[model samples]
Target: MMHPLSMPELPSGIARVQFEPERVDYAAPEASGRQGGVQAGWPLWLATFELEKVDRDSADMWRGFIARLRGRQRLFLASDPTRLYPKAAPRGFAGMVRAGGGAFNGSAIAWAQNVDADGNADIGLTGLPEGLALSVGDFIGFKWDATGAAAGTYGRRTMARVVIPGVVSNAGAVTVGIEPPLDMLVVPAGAIAHLDRPACLMRQIPDRSSIGSIGTGGALSGAVLVAGQDLRP
Candidate 1:
């Protein structure tokens, strides 16, 4: 019954990727000891795909995506395996997809009037379609569901990664700057935010050297995969 997975249309021999953010450094003890570590929760997004030259059908499709992530009960929505999109946009995700006709920020409802912890905020856009652009590692997806909702229970999904970068201010505002923050507690302006491919909702830990095939001309390499340890569902 584990038939609820997504995000796995990436295959190209993967050269080198490393999506970041993997916190939980707590270590502020005292009594004559260590005292310099903070970040304590909500920081899980780690990708590290690294497939070298490939062949043999891209090494059997990267070992069939590391055997369908079965070593960890398969869940999906991973990203940044060298970036999924929004790195300059420019008609990429259809340049925000709907403009004069509405629905760019999903029917003009993308919001975020307040947010801080590190995941800065200021996204209140409208139909943007004039050569889109959002920089700094791009990756966005916050929710409380509003326009065209779907993440049941009123959406609790939240993903971030832009480190401060902006544009699109001809009215359809823009002032993003996210990080490891914005996961609810109060992000309700009805809350909504979306940028093409911002992902992170994972479960993986493949092994068996991850992948294989490295001889007889069909060169291949490890198809490593790792997530935030085990954040369970």
Candidate 2:
């Protein structure tokens, strides 16, 4: 029998390009619209990516992975909503604004993204650890690893939502485009994006009455997923 680790050959209709949003700074005029007036700053430039439903087998596999990534178990990373805020000292800029929580309005428990060399990608949840609890609108942060590297090398990580924006991916190909066009109504209000630390390992999984160390004694902390799209499919 084939070992469970022996991932099945991906079936047809599976796109492998993973997309994520990057946190960027933005500025706005003061309420009075006058000079020397206080201004509000927030995070913008939320990108997007699509998780093509590959074949029935691939889809099922992806579905399970996504379930775990977005699962209810709390994860601690290098970054969170607090760091996602605007770096500049702009007045009226609040930290950790809650807009519901989790993708699909909290219906799902976990989330994650994975991409291939050909730009093929997938994003979704796997499952939540048993006996874990999470309330709606709770603040979560993610530390994105920014150091790009070759396959198997450690790099930054970020948590973004899967937004199929007019892109199509099948078994062996990937296509990308803007879902909500820039300078348009693509990004929602009060949204921000940021990257996690390198090799962003999800360790120290919390249990019913204690936390367990899975990697480096770190925990898996959930972050506010604003929105994201892949530039390439």
Candidate 3:
């Protein structure tokens, strides 16, 4: 797992990050009844980041990062550096980088992350974090430690969206419902499960004018960046 403190090699001008919830709603009218509306399942998330005063050196760095990404690569995102999860069980949004570019002057750049773009996987586990309550829309992380008989089936770090919410069963097990089922049949026993609120995928829409300024003297002048989410097969 990559260390959270280790800065991701992204554009240099990123200054702030923001998150938005994604939801779908439907309304219907009956011949003899009032209109009714229904909200879909748990809300997915979107993230946005702001870049400020990107300079020429930063522009080159941004270009290099973008080139490496190839326009839709799945990468882990750490919105908060201080709140990073443990190396053994890192938790964050698994997303793909969207295709975007800055102005000719390289003053600013816009980027976005889509949570549902990658979809989810269904996983069943034998243990539940004691006294922990899970709800729909909560963000969870799954880690398959390289141990146990089923270790080879599970991979490293993966994130998912909770689709069904229920209590721990009498058998001392909790069946987690996630979108997009896990590729393997069984998760390693005692695999790490992380629960966190305020976690989501991010995407930013920057002002085009912010990318038109050229650096003067040795001062940085604008920003550029790209981001995306990993879609499930």
Badly placed stretches (over 4 Å) of model 2 are: 1-27, 30-47, 72-233
- Per-candidate TM-scores read 0.33, 0.23, 0.40
Taking every candidate in turn, the Cα RMSD to the unseen true structure, in Å, is 15.7, 20.5, 14.3
Clashes of each: 1, 56, 31
Task: Estimate every model's Cα lDDT from 0 to 1.
Answer: 0.59, 0.26, 0.40
lDDT of 1 by residue, 1-233 (tens): 23335544664767777778777777778888767667677677777777777777867665676577666776666666455557775334543555454545433345555565654564545555554667887777654532354555332344677777776665555766677665454445564566755565566765423664577777776656565422322
Off by over 4 Å in 1: 1-10, 14-20, 29-46, 50-53, 56-99, 102-113, 117-123, 128-138, 141-213, 223-233
Candidates 2 and 3 compared by TM-score, better number? 3
Summarize candidate 3's per-residue lDDT along 40-76 as a digit string, tens digits: 6444344444556655676556545444443333243
Write down the TM-score for model 1. 0.33
Which parts of model 3 have CA positions greater than 4 angstroms off? 1-13, 29-43, 54-61, 73-140, 143-191, 195-214, 217-228, 231-233
* Residue 167 error, candidate 3, Å: 18
Q: Ten consecutive residues with minimal summed lDDT in candidate 2?
A: 1-10
